[model samples]
Target: MTPPAPSDENLLPAPVLVVEDDPLMRQRLALVLDGLGYAREAITFSQSLGEARAYASNNPLAMALVDLGLPDGNGIELIEELRAQDPSLLILVISAWSTEESILGALRAGATGYVLKERDDLEVSLSIRSVLRGGAPIDPFIARRILALLPVAADHIEPEEPPRPVEAGVLSARESEILELVSQGLTNREIAEQLVISRYTAECHIKRIYRKLAVSSRTRAVNEARQRGLLP
Candidate 1:
């Protein structure tokens, strides 16, 4: 049975890319994309890191569902490469492997969402929509592991040396506010909407914040801010 087309105008105009080595998995993912209202011709599939990289070179992707295990190379390499190409590209890790290292690595590499292949098709579709709406769609198990990795002050544990105090004035008030929102896990699009600023303006502020904090990832920026007492 054919599914109806997507009505959301905000959905990406470019086709969704799927990088998975397994043929069956690729077909399954295509069905899921169909459920999301992506026409068959609107989907691109690659079986390995090399093939995926090649496709990404010529195409402008709106989002990619990547499998970590690839025949030619690691999928994280492709994630990094695509991220370098388009900072706004939404990358989602879809893999059977759930190692904490793999999950966190993908996120740090610029993936906006992570979902275990064992999840239901509906869940995966929901995750796609969630990320498209400017939310991180992490699996529950992965979410718990991530939460555990975050540092929390514990009275029973001995305190380490405090972080070097960062001059709060280094960032302008607006930039500081943007950083705070970034720390709260808001995407650039969401931040722009929340602050009534342009998306380009929000992105510019985020880049400036990253440079000032000397950090690459959102987690690192937030941690540095907390360590330097920039955030409470």
Candidate 2:
């Protein structure tokens, strides 16, 4: 069964590790975590991969926000190491790097979500919160980039008959509406505001959508919906 969605109350006691070389970016992430109800003492900041590794060795972490470019080494290495350490750890890549290699590498290395550093504070906060809530939140630009590669990837596959299109009525009208908002990169809170529903209700709809789609992450759900003709 799918786990319950995480809330601010549950996240309050979970420790978070932030690995970023830029002082400004580190401070910004710290502020975001604070705003999300993470205590200052519960959040740990490391300026280099070595420091992050050091902290990880001695402490248990619930989540980690990492950057791709670091002073000591690529952050992907740290991500791999952390994932090896704790399979349940929620890792989100928050970096200026948007290259296809960097993006795909992070995901393959077990990042739960990936967002560009160029996104504004609100977008970053939403992505972080989504990760905490067991949602995989990819930046819109990143999502588009991944989608653009789908056809290219399919080119290498052996020819076969086309698959049947997904039935439109497989999802309820309300579920379809929620999926549309999700495809537009809206968070549950934003979706709730847009549809005049409570955030909890919005989350329930999203979980139902995920179940129907047989996908665990928002990015996968949107991609599956589009492949099945559920979205434009």
Top-scoring candidate (TM-score)? 2
Looking at model 2, residue 149 earns an lDDT score of 81
What are the per-residue Cα lDDT tens digits for candidate 1 across 62-85? 788999999888888888888776
Where does model 1 exceed 4 Å of error? 1-5, 8-12, 152-232
lDDT of each: 0.77, 0.81
lDDT of 1: 0.77
Candidate 1 residue-wise lDDT at 123? 83
Clashes of 2: 0
Lowest summed-lDDT stretch of 10 residues in model 2? 160-169
Segments of candidate 2 deviating more than 4 angstroms: 1-8, 154-232
TM-score of candidate 1 relative to the true fold: 0.62
